[model samples]
Target: MSGCVFCRIVAGSVPSFQVVGEPSGVAFLDSRPVFRGHVLVVPRPHLETLTDLPEADLAGYFGLVRRVAAAVESGLDAGGTFVAMNNRVSQSVPHLHTHVVPRTKGDGLRGFFWPRTRYDDDGQAATYAARIGAAVAPPTRG
Candidate 1:
C-alpha cells in the first residue's frame, strides 16, 4: 500500500486534484480525463480490486461513487453519467476505484466505450436489470 499511488494520495504523501475527501474514501479529478469532469473515487484503505473490497465497505464506497456521479452529472450539465470500474486486467491502479465520467449526447465517444447495445425491448431490459438486481445483497450495517 505504501508504494501504491492511490494509497499515497489517500495518505497525503502524493498530491492529487482532490474533489472530495471523506473518511470513507476520496474523490478527485482525473489527471488524464477522457472528457471534462472525469472523476475517480477511491477507498481510503488500499484495495487491489473490486473483489478485494470488504462487503461492509460497499455502502460507503458506493455512496461516495453515487455522490460523485451526481456531481459529474449536475456540475457539467451532462446528458447522463458513465460509471465504470475495471478489474485486474485494464486497471492501471491496483487499488479499488470507480470512474464517474460526464457524458453528453453526440459527443463522439466511439468504439472503445460508445455505441452501447440496447435491449430488444423494455421487457428484455427489465429482465436483465432484475436479474442483476436480484443478485445484489443488501448493504450490511457498519
Candidate 2:
C-alpha cells in the first residue's frame, strides 16, 4: 500500500489533475485516460481486489463511483459512460479501483472488447449470464 501510486496520490504525495476525496474513498482524473474525463475511484483503505474489500465498504465505494460518474457526465457532456473494475486476470495494478470513462458518439470504444471464442447460441449466453448473476447478486443479509 505504501508504494501504490494511487495511495500516494491520495496521500497528496503525488500531484494529480483533479481529485475529490471523501472520508471513505477518493476519485481522481486518470493520467492515462482511455477517454476524456476519465476518472479512477479508489478506497482510502488499501485493497488489492474487489474480494479483498469488506462487504460494508461496498456501498460507500460504489456510491462514490456513481457520484464521480455523474460529475464526469455533466462536466464533459458525454453521450455515455463506462464503469469497470478489473480483477486478477485483467488487473493492471494491484489495487482496488474503478474506472469511470466518459463516452462520446464518435468514440471508437465499442465496449471493452477482448478476443474470445464466439458463443454458440442464445442458450449458452443465458446459461453463462445466470451463473455470473448468481455470484454477483448481493447477499440477502447484507
Candidate 3:
C-alpha cells in the first residue's frame, strides 16, 4: 500500500488531474485516457481489490464514480459510458479503483468481443444477466 501509486495520490504525495476529492473517495482524469473525459475513482483507504474493501468504502467509492460519470456525460455530450475495474490478476496499480469512461459512437473501444456462439433469443440474454447479477449481489450481511 505504501509503494502503490494510487495510495501516493490519495496521500497527496503525487499530483493528479483531480476532478473531485471527498472524504471517502477521489476522482481524477486518467493519464492514459481510453476516451476523452476518462476518470478514475478510488477510495482513500488502501485496498488491493473490491473484496478487500469494506462495504461502506466500496459503496461510497462507486457513488463517487456515478457522480463523475454524470459530469462526464453532461460536459462531454457522450452517448454512453463504460465503468470498469480490474482485480489482482488484471490490475496495473495493485490498488482498488474504478474507471469511468465517456464513450462515443466510434470510440474504437471494443470491450469483451470474444468469439462465442450467438444467443438464440432475448431469453438467453436475460438469463445471463440475471445469473451474473445474482452472483455479484452484495453480501446480505453488509
Candidate 4:
C-alpha cells in the first residue's frame, strides 16, 4: 500500500483537499473534479476495488459515503448528487473510492463521458472542501 495514492492521502503524507476525515474513511475533493464540489470517499485502510471491501466494513464505509452525498448536495446548494463507484474497469486509482458529484438541472453531463475540470487553485479546492465538510452531519442508524 506504500505506492497507493489513496493510502498516502489517508496517511497525511500526501496533501489533499480533505472534507471528511473519520475512523470510517476519508473524503476529499477530486483533484480533477467533474464539478467544483466533487468528492471522493475512500476507506481509511487500503482496499482495492469494491469487491475487496470486507462485509464488516460495508455499513461504516457506506454510511460515510451517504453522509458525503448529502453534504455535497446541501453544502453546494445543488439540486442533487450523482454517486458512483468503478470496480476494476476504469478504476483510476485501483483504490476503493466512491465519487459523489454535485449535480444541477441542465448541467450537460451525460452518461459515463465525464469531462474533468480543475479548481482555480489550492485555495479554491480548499474552499469547496470546507463547504461540504461543514454540511456533513454525524451518521445516524436506521
Per-residue lDDT of candidate 1, residues 1-142 (tens digit): 8889999988888876676777778876666667655678999998889898899988889987886776666555678878999998879898988987668898888645634333455454344333322332333455
For residue 125, give model 3's deviation from the true position in Å.
Answer: 39
Cα lDDT tens digits for candidate 2, 8-115: 988889876544677668776666567545677889887999999999888878877877776666655677788999987787777899988777787777667622
How many residue-pair clashes does candidate 3 contain? 0
Q: What lDDT does the true structure give each of the candidates?
A: 0.72, 0.69, 0.68, 0.94
Query: Candidate 2, clashing residue pairs?
Result: none
lDDT by residue (1-142, candidate 3, tens digit) is 7788998998889876666677768776666666545678898888888898887576666767776776667656778788888898768798888887777897677874312233445454344323322322222333
Which of candidates 1 and 3 is the stronger one according to lDDT? Answer: 1
Residue pairs with colliding backbones in model 3 are none
**Candidate 4 structure lDDT:** 0.94
Best-first order by lDDT: 4, 1, 2, 3
Runs off by more than 4 Å, candidate 2: 113-142
For each of the candidates, the C-alpha root-mean-square deviation to the true structure, in angstroms, is 12.2, 13.8, 13.3, 1.0
CA deviation > 4 Å runs, candidate 1: 111-142
Cα TM-score per model: 0.77, 0.75, 0.75, 0.97
TM-score of predicted structure 3 = 0.75
lDDT of 4 by residue, 1-142 (tens): 8999999999999999999899999999999999999999999888988888899989999999999999999999999999999998899998899999999999999998899999999999999999999999997767
